[model samples]
Target chain A: MYLFRNYLLVFNILIFFQVSIFANNRDSILVIGKVSNNPQKHYSYLKPMLNYAVSHMKDLGIKKGKVLMARDNNQMIQYLQEGKIDWITESIFSALIYQQTTNAELLVRKWKKHSPNYYTIFISKKGNDINQLTDLKGRKIVLEDPGSSTAFYVPLMEMINAGLTLEFLHSVEKKPSGNNVGYIFANSEINIATWVFKGLVDAGAYNNEDWKKVDHTPVVFRKKLNIFHKSDTLPRSIEVVRNDLPDPIKKRLKSILLNIENDPSARNVLFAYQKTKKFDEINEDINNELNRARIVLNKVHENLNSL
Target chain B: MTMIIQCLKKINKLIFLILIPSLVQANSDLKPLLEVLKENETISSEQFEKIVDAVDNNDKNNLGIPAQINTKKNDEKELLIKIDNGLKISTYDGSANFSVGGRMMIDTAYYSDDKQPIGDGTEFRRARIEFNGKMYEVWSYQLDVEFGGGSADAKEVFLSYDGFTNKRIKIGQNKAPFSLEELTSSKHTTFMENALPNVFAIGRRVGILYESYQENWTFAAGFFGESFDNDVSKEGDESWGLSGRTTFTPVSEDTKVLHFGASLNYFDQEDNSEVRFRSRPESHVTDTRYLDTGKIKDVEKQYSYGLEFAAVLGPFSFQTEYINTHLERKIGGADDLDFFGYYMYGSWFITGESRAYKSKSGKFDRVKPLNEFGAIELALRYSMVDLTNGSVTGGETDQYTFGLNWYIKPNIKIMGNYVRVDNDINADEDGGVIGDDDPNIWQMRFQLDF
Candidate 1:
């Protein structure tokens, strides 16, 4: 009975969130939003593309482009609801929130890093004897930031589904009691890799793509690490426009980005924009993939938070 | 066969229909699936309506609806773009890519002659264009062509595949798994030139290498032969070799790291049976080698091993390596020889920009400046090589070097190194110069990469 009440409460909260009011703060300029703790890097990456997009949108009343950075996912959602940001590129988990909670339109799917999907992996030292997700009990694992889908939510979901009880570690020194897995957020992928490599924690979780990237998971560290667990493929990142954005403007912006790869002049600009190859329309295949992804994402959000 | 497949699909839908009346929830995900089937003509309109009515719809849930589906028309191929990351000439699916980049290092040296006349001049140390890229995501390749030393040569031309789990394989001309100092890319090396002990490192050879690494350690091994441009005129059959290296890091972070590694190289000179060991005085402007073994014949096998250690703490870093080489005379009694060398170095960034270290390759990466002007670093190194053992008094020499570097940009830098060479009595260019000679060398470089 109590479980049912909790479900009811979660459903009510989700419904309340879905009926969000978008602020009509539209102006002559187009605002591109990003969620990042490192504003400088994110700004430079977003600026050129925003300028390119705005340049092509002069006929649609977009005279200039501005980049706004949100420090976290929740803040970015608030910005979108308030119409302070007209367009945003987001990872799957946060993108799901914007899609469900507000009238934002998913403009196109961004092939981030040129791949439409990436998976999360759980890593431990080579000889930890932790071969599977269940072995993480009574030990600690490190994650990236709370805003990360691969580093945080997907792994959290896997643990919950595996029936492992979770206890949040306030510090590395803290330990979980019997039969519980303790976890902490290390703020960056490299930090998570470092903590696991140094044995400050029993394991770490992040995307498989980062596992291959030398800068994130150093080659030295990879020599003695073991990826004991992997999650299902998650949806790639997405681009979305606020619900109230003009239809013509939204369509024009999307058309420009989907065709950006064919433009010779935008070569460096596209390369600098984040190694994006081209945007894709969310076709039937993608729609089905997204359905599965969102279901698990919703459950992860609702189930993990109360714990 | 197509008709059979279509029939199988319809049969699956019939099963789905038979089960849904008992299992379907009004807000269940099956609504989309049903709509898809109907749109694709898997179910007739009459049948769809009948099934839609026969199912007892439960309470409506508003948990999973994208607003665009309810209020906006999304069938149009409108677009949106986002980028935040990676490589070049990349395919849309990230399966293939290509990029070209290279570096130009122009150097000048002033040799303070002591007992020998060493040339003092400027030259291009390394002028090379490199083409590198990935194909099919897991396959990668690099081709580096060097136009230095008044000639053109291929350096580190290789193709690699990383498709396996936590492992990679490379085949072509590349560096053997040997020294931490030798493996680090020249573009990011602290000093303009490697230390005196680098002569013991058998650098870039044609080979195939296998590498596997985990969180705290790495293991690399390879089979190699003579360099690409080896002369077949005197060819009694090229020497073949095997080399392997293993490294472990107890701690690795953004600004803190501790690394220890060991390597072994074995060469079989079954037919050639001759070798020479030589090195410059840690400076390239003068081709005069202060230490040279000339030629040692009747060699059957060559054995070498190296030990390496390095660390980085904030803006300060330390590295040391020791190498030992032993040769087995095929037919001579008591004619075996041994040569050993070692180098220790430390560097600090006074401008507070830490030397970037790549734990992946166990090497120091390029350091970028923090401020607009540039970054400055002061470094010192002490290296010793003793090629004099038993019957082979090739020579022995030691060097003390001081270096200062100014990195004006990530891709451009200026470096100055002052080296003092101390030679023993047998230290001469294969009896071509006076032994016990000492030289003070000052060298500078202007480097840029694109």
Candidate 2:
């Protein structure tokens, strides 16, 4: 009787398992993706970091995924909501919008050059005698892209923090120019670098990556420009996952990923990229910092709205 | 004559009552002509009549004058075609769109004068129809149909509900996701059709599919399956089965996207049922011998296995898959056959643009400037399969393919490929000997959307 009962129980369990497959069609997982926009040409500095991420997905159970090549923030967000993706590595502005709309979590921030920081570098022509950030108050300045994290956000924030009033002496007309001191979306850092070198803009602000590429401080503005100020370091890019993901799977993925370098099985994929060590533990301090950024932006938005 | 005059007077009175005060709304009114107005209303009517009179005279500034020559503006809607499988209908706002797409491939095989010719090289490959779209903010669906020369003709439809729960439940005809090529959209296949190994175990299937995806991973499970083209009535109780597949890209949102995947299928055939093959036939028996399709068969048994791999790079990428299967055959004499096949293909863009994605800050842009002429792409593929591991023979087949593609626009592309097939015969002599005897085939395709 006991044996028969056990067999019956097993049979019953099997049947139940079979029925649930069709009965439950309502489970979900987060989908995430990011693109370097331009790896070979513009964002070459960030390529090593991306390769590290690609070579080591087996440790996280990811087998086949697509890296979308995109050129605009709008396209990136569209992919995210289209079920074509779940996660994204993007600028703070884009991430802010996604987090607010999708309730996606900010998992971890990257540390560039082994430091969790970044800053904007202001540059000018060779010999025009623009020594201070304030001195360019009424002059023209070139901006890389309106959505650029470093070229726009960092500089804008620093300006506000420093109480430097911005009066659009005149908006930079989007014309193809070697150099002109106006807010122009050059579409690339090299273009911006070239513009400053050729005496197009009176001054400009770019991240350290762009600054490092230029051999001469300024050829056109060789005597015109000087570093007026530098902003404080901000957090690097972040890795985020949807909060609704299963805890166990998420935990396993995170554990395997954070310590990928130590796992023999994951070394080759991880080693493809550089400037990445490991995912450190996240805590309240990081959250607090993110909150501070949000607060600052909210204030700006409120001011804009009131006006 | 007097009566006629009196009637005329009454008609004039009625005309006045109807036409005098309502003259302002006359443009909107359609009525019988010839009416009279009361004397008192005639003053108001006179003013109205003056307006009408002015309009009747084609006055330059009358209310009845043509409402500006440009009142009816010609606002035309734009049409965009997405190449994924359908032609999408989008409005000016781009917030809403509906897409309808389809594919049809008729391939005839002509078996060369080999020692044994199974059916020569001649048969219809596939006839397909697909409907897909994003209805609004939170809904999307895809329906597919297949009709062609095969063991069976069938219809497979999947109604997908995406976004509501971040889950997609496909109820209809599709794959169970047991293989890498099995889950990829057929439209994007490197070959005109999937490998023969896929036809045996991971062919297109029909079932209840529940799939969930995260940034780099996808988990899908389903049950109550159907054969590739089997009819619902023929299934009976034996038709029931279970299948599931999981896919993950460990490195997503990076310049190089890497992925891994695994899948399973389990079935319980009816007692005394001769249903050994799933959707595709395992072997073709002839007077000479049997031609294997690379499948393990069992009358009443479970089917399951695992597959894993990675895909990486930008304008260039590569993929690999490993599979294992066991079968329980009804005949006591033969054991289940086991086989494995792996393929790697790489693609590079000679043009400035990159692969299309839904992100703005990515390598490629669909809305490239008009100054750009077009994009050129080159791809190479190599695949090897060992089909005689567990059967009566031991033979391995290898193939190399090279392709060149021209993308004239976002919605148009022309592609041509040359493939070389090499065979290594080690199994029974009946397996056919081709001491590296090779064959080269050429194919070309032109694709357009929208």
Candidate 3:
């Protein structure tokens, strides 16, 4: 009777172990993203690329991959904290937020939309007196959405560092008084250009790529505006993996992404994946820049708390 | 001093009761109001300082109106409407999407004097409205209607399942998998009309098709019956066909592409078995078809095949196609008939724009201008068709055409073409025999698509 009981206990343990192993293999890797309002469109472009990467990692025990999109950064943080998302690709600012909030580790730099990096440009009408960031006191300026790094955070950080007192205005037309630069969020790059060109705002700030694009700034508008200042270049986007992910899977994913350009079979999938040019290891310079951005973000938080 | 202290305490209690709500309501700093109270002698200096500290602490702890928690669930699905270069409407969550777009082609042509009467006039070559959308994330559908050719016609109306990677299955009326020129959208074609080889290409039909594509290649095959609104046979007999096409790109890039493709079609005719092949002189407004196979009678089966080759090098491109069709007669002792045609064309963009290539479909897409004024394209083509096979006397003809196109925008263009036609003595137009009459034609079209 004692021998039979021990045998049954061993058998049950084996079954449980097998079941757990199967469950892990079912969705071994999860690629997560923040859901754009257009989840289906986003999924359509994202699924194939992730599938390509997952297929290449089958030897690494990644049998399958799944994609999950959070509605916002807060939800994304929740998912990351729960270990539901093992890998991620997002803008640098969002990556920083996720890094600070969930301890996600940056894996590599991504050349999203075929651009490796972009810089913010401060613009005003050609005849305007605001040729530099210091002259923007007591005037209205427009920036892109608050979530945008190049258009919002980078430009705002530049102004703050230039010793200009800044106030977020409820509207673009509301002017602030006495050495304070009033700014409003335009929510779109084209809107920023239009607001500055039409004199609705005294100046505007956005990425230099948008400033050079004809669709955002037409030839006529281009002639009317002048880029007086440009911020330091920042990485276009980055890839991250949860710190708790298995070392082998993380290594395999990084290897696959970094070598996708060398694999001709992944060409179409890569092109469809937001027209990504390639992936490369994040250099020390970029890492240092990210650290600097973290400091700026921390300072901003401290200032807000002091208020 | 005791009386003053008592009065100040009473006033401070009243002020706290009144100003606390104001402070919460205003969402402002407490220092300014506290200073004002001290200046007005409403409170002592020590009381003012204490109250200021308490208010600041309360504000820091968010003891205000609970900071609008944004508890409002964002359950209302947002509908996104955008009008940039095109018009598109989609659900914010992307579970469902829809787009309404259309295209118009206005054509005019003038023909030189010919032995047979040929009409020269203006006509609406193609005017179509299309609705495309996705449902359930995996299903997509398109419905297109044409009002050109002076009548309403249904074009592509199909629903597709795109659940698999690099593959899709479609059902309903759609173009049969065939030649490259026949598959490319008319709005993006180099010429206003397709070339002679298109005569043998199976056009649109009601069908079910399966398609799969890789990075540099595509394969499409389908089984099709008569097109929508096709005339019903007397005994409800329907013709059916099986067709397939495959294309491979040995080298494909943004500015360069080399393509090779082939297609095969087998069609089973109805009991009557009557098929006709005809083409105009590279112009839409002209009604006379100098090259006509008239009618092949008692056709049991028809088999057609096409070969396509195309290449794009920077600002220049070359395209050519050859197609042949064989007919089997039902009557005994009747020899089988064969018809063949081919066309070659070359185009150069004066403003330096390469024709966009869609690798998934193995076809050329719209041309986008690099400049504000737009891009210019110059092209020349030579085509020949021979319908003179055993026991068939469908005259032979050759045509040379020169074209000029102005792309004002990605979706709008103006085009002009000059064609010179050469016909053999056996050629006939409008059921009249023409003794080797050659004609020159001039055609123009204004087109728009969104």
Best by TM-score: 3
Stretches of candidate 3 exceeding 4 Å from the true structure: A1-31, A34-41, A49-88, A101-236, A240-271, A275-307, B1-77, B270-272, B433-435
Q: Write the per-residue lDDT of candidate 1 for residues A1-307, one digit (tens) a residue.
A: 9999999999998877665322222466798877754444465467668878988988776776776766555566677777778888888877877888786788888888778888999999998899999999899989886668899878888998898987776688988889899888888887888899999999999999889865577665787899999987865789988899888988898899899989987765565566677788889877886887777777765665355
- Candidate 3 docking band: incorrect
DockQ of each: 0.02, 0.02, 0.14
Worst 10 contiguous positions by lDDT, candidate 3 chain B: B63-72
lDDT of candidate 3 over B214-287, digit per residue (tens): 76799999999989988764665778999999999988766689999999999999764888988776787876
- Of the candidates numbered 2 and 3, which has the greater DockQ value? 3
Kindly report which residue stretches of model 2 are placed more than 4 angstroms away from their true locations once superposed: A1-307, B1-130, B133-140, B145-156, B161-166, B189-196, B232-238, B271-298, B302-306, B314-316, B331-334, B345-378, B389-396, B406-411, B424-437
Model 2 chain A scores worst on lDDT over the 10 consecutive residues at A38-47
**What is the C-alpha lDDT profile of model 2 across A1-307, one tens digit per residue?**
9999999999999999878753332222233345443222222222233334434444444443333333344444444444345446555555665576566667666543355656678887756777766666556666675566678656655655655543322234433223212354566676666566666667788776556432222222223456666765556566655555556545655665567657654432333333444555556766666675665555543332232
Show where candidate 1 strays beyond 4 Å. A1-93, A97-307, B1-87
User: Model 2 over residues B155-258: C-alpha lDDT tens digits?
Assistant: 55666654322356777776665776665554455444444346335455667878765434677787765565565456356446788777766665323566
RMSD (Å) of each candidate, 1 decimal: 23.8, 18.5, 8.7
lDDT tens per residue, model 1, B253-296: 66688999999999998688878999898898788887999888
**Among all candidates shown, the one with the greatest lDDT:** 3
Q: Alpha carbon lDDT of residue A176, candidate 1?
A: 87
Tens-place lDDT digits, model 3, residues A1-307? 9999999999999999999987776456655555464565676767777788778887777766665665556556766777767877788888898899878999999898799988889999988888889989888889886667787778778888898877777776577778888878887887888788889999999887787664566555677899989988888889988888888888888888999999887777776777788999988988887887887667654553553
Candidate 1 vs 2: which has more TM-score: 1
Worst 10 residues of 3 chain A by lDDT: A298-307
TM-score of each: 0.54, 0.48, 0.69
